[model samples]
Target: MNLVPGSEGGFAALHAWAIATAAVVAAGCALVGTLLVVRRMSLLGDAISHAVLPGIVLAVLAGGRPGGFAVLGGAVVAAVVTVLLVQALRSEGGVAEDAGTGVVFTTLFAVGVVLASALARRIDLDPSCVLYGVLEFVPFDTVAVAGLEVPRAFLTGVVVLGLVGAGLAATWKDQVFAAFDAEAARAVGVPVAAVTTGLLAATALVTVASFEAVGAILVVAMLVVPAAAAELLVRRLAWMAVVAVVLGVAAACLGYMAAYRLDTSAAGMIAVVLGLEYAVAAIVAPEDGVLARGAARARLAWRVRCEDLLARLWRADEARAGPPAATGPGDWAAAAWLRVSGRIVRDGDRWGLTAPGRAEAETVVRSHRLWEAWLGRHVELPLDHLHPPAEWIEHHLGADVRRRIEAEVGGEESDPHGRAIPRERGRPNA
Candidate 1:
């Protein structure tokens, strides 16, 4: 079996193998990336992805097959060297971590570019191979597996994914502890340093495995984007890892199909798709997404506006005066909603609370005046300042809290302003 453009069956197999390879490698990257992002070592992953190129080229030159265990070992060694060089610069030379990282990775990556270009014929690597991978050509390179011809890139991706997944699972608790509190974890004998070394090694392995399929830069995108999006969608580390792997694989499959349809770079399309997934996650995430937060704010504002309207009407009723005119946008909206709910009625250019509304209004006024009394008793603020705090807090007080505050305020009938404090409905005054 030959994989050539002229054969329809070969082209179909090529597409399937390419997508499968991308998905498996993306999963590996996502798993390692979850830890890296949580530990705030995402920059380290990016550096390793680019910096391993010279080591890989050297290993291949030394007769180690590309995507083999020897190549993986070389990559891990290169990644460790990159981290050590960065740390040395930071500790010994008094350089900042970010600055040291910038210097080390860029220098090493540049050296790799030169080596790969200089020995292009020997290593079969070109300039494009350094940045954009040869994913579309993956099926052309095959190895026999159990009487079946399998694409070597896909096999490499599966092996790396399994190794990374198993390593992370076996050390998940330590990883979580170190991610959140490295100093405390180390003090408690969690082997944070070994865990960190293993993580870096895993990053290097995943990066090298995906190198032939998605290149250096796009692999970084695969490593960071899905994990970041998953973090936004979940709070637990285990759940986050699962979601990240799913998102990464979905992005890989969708991106490959899109690239095939559009006749574009598959690696580039995969990165773009990952970006889109992150944007969507940011907008619609479960608890703290932009839309969810906005809706929560709106609901709180609505409750405050309506409660203020009711309290104002109650005060007017007490004074035996007409309701205050609704002038502001907030007042008008609250007024319309109250009238619709039968909490208020239009009486010839004025408003008045119904019987049920009056009871609820009394509760609001009680909470407000009780808070004002408490503030006046404990806080040294002037009368005017007390009103501001009570006005802001009145809507949040519940019956139990109000009862507690009423007792704490020593059953004061009048606030510091000398206004009559409304009693809680159905409760006898002391």
Candidate 2:
């Protein structure tokens, strides 16, 4: 097929079918991947993918065709075996977790490879086909259901994805508790082992279904990257799952289009795009992402330092103290910015706060002192220890928490160091 850019006028149906197929596969991978990432068992997903080959080959040899129940059964058995062997090695041989997983899955994969090679003449199985299924040709395979022809692979992916989705929804709470604190979940009789086993089996099924469209190795990318990206974007599990599903589906559609445009493999394109999504999330996500919170904190710290410097400048002018001592680098930069903003003026080499700057400066000092007073009453830290923590926290504390602290402390007049606390809004009554 000659690749073309943009959606052609007649390709709407094709695009819809492709995107629907991709979404089904993406959802399955993301759902399973969420649990894998939460449990820190990502390698287990890899193991199951590799080990399913022999079972699939054996099932085919036993007269089961692709997308048949026999193939799913064989894959499930293979997945369970891989998990059991890894557990046994870890418990008995004292092997490290990764090493045990590596040893078990590689051994099973090797066994499958040998069996498939020996039986190649008698079987229709291809090693390359086992590694990567022909997803592009999936729409060609049709079955009559209710007198209507439907893509068999699409139907299979939907059924399997639905089952996984239902199981996850039903066990959502238990899964969350187990993932957050396995020991606590076990103590509460949450059937942690059963949950883990069920998750692994579902992962195996998802991998099998997706293998036709996404291939074996690339399925790992679908399973981990979206969920991992969502984790960066959200804190709550439900939100994380929701975000992950959306991201996965979007990536699936966009990747397929990109691959078609570039005359590339759809599976490879989706994996590459998913990796890109994760990288973007890592850079731009708030709170924990590399760029977001870091930049926010940097800006906030600079603001605080500037305010402090302005306040110090005002006090220096009032007390007839020479120039304020050189402040920290961030504070110095903030001071320069503040001066440029017309909130401060440079008188010779020394800086002085403008009237507007003095007001802003007072608000910062008031927040700091109120926090110190609150801490002195509520926390048992020493006088000097109180300042450092309050310095960071004073920025985040809202007016409501300040009022609550004031009420708790009976409206203290002075902080631990006997410094008169600044009033809110420069009002004496405050």
Candidate 2 lDDT for residue 104 = 87
RMSD of each candidate relative to the true structure: 2.7, 4.8
Candidate 2 lDDT over residue span 15-67, tens digit each: 55666777898998898899899889888998888888888889889998666
Cα lDDT over the full model 1: 0.89
Candidate 1 clash pair list: none
Q: Which portions of model 2 miss their true places by more than 4 Å? A: 1-19, 325-430
Candidate 1 regions with alpha-carbon error over 4 angstroms: 1-7, 347-349, 425-430
Q: For all candidates, what are the clash counts? A: 0, 0
TM-score for each candidate, following the candidate numbering: 0.93, 0.80
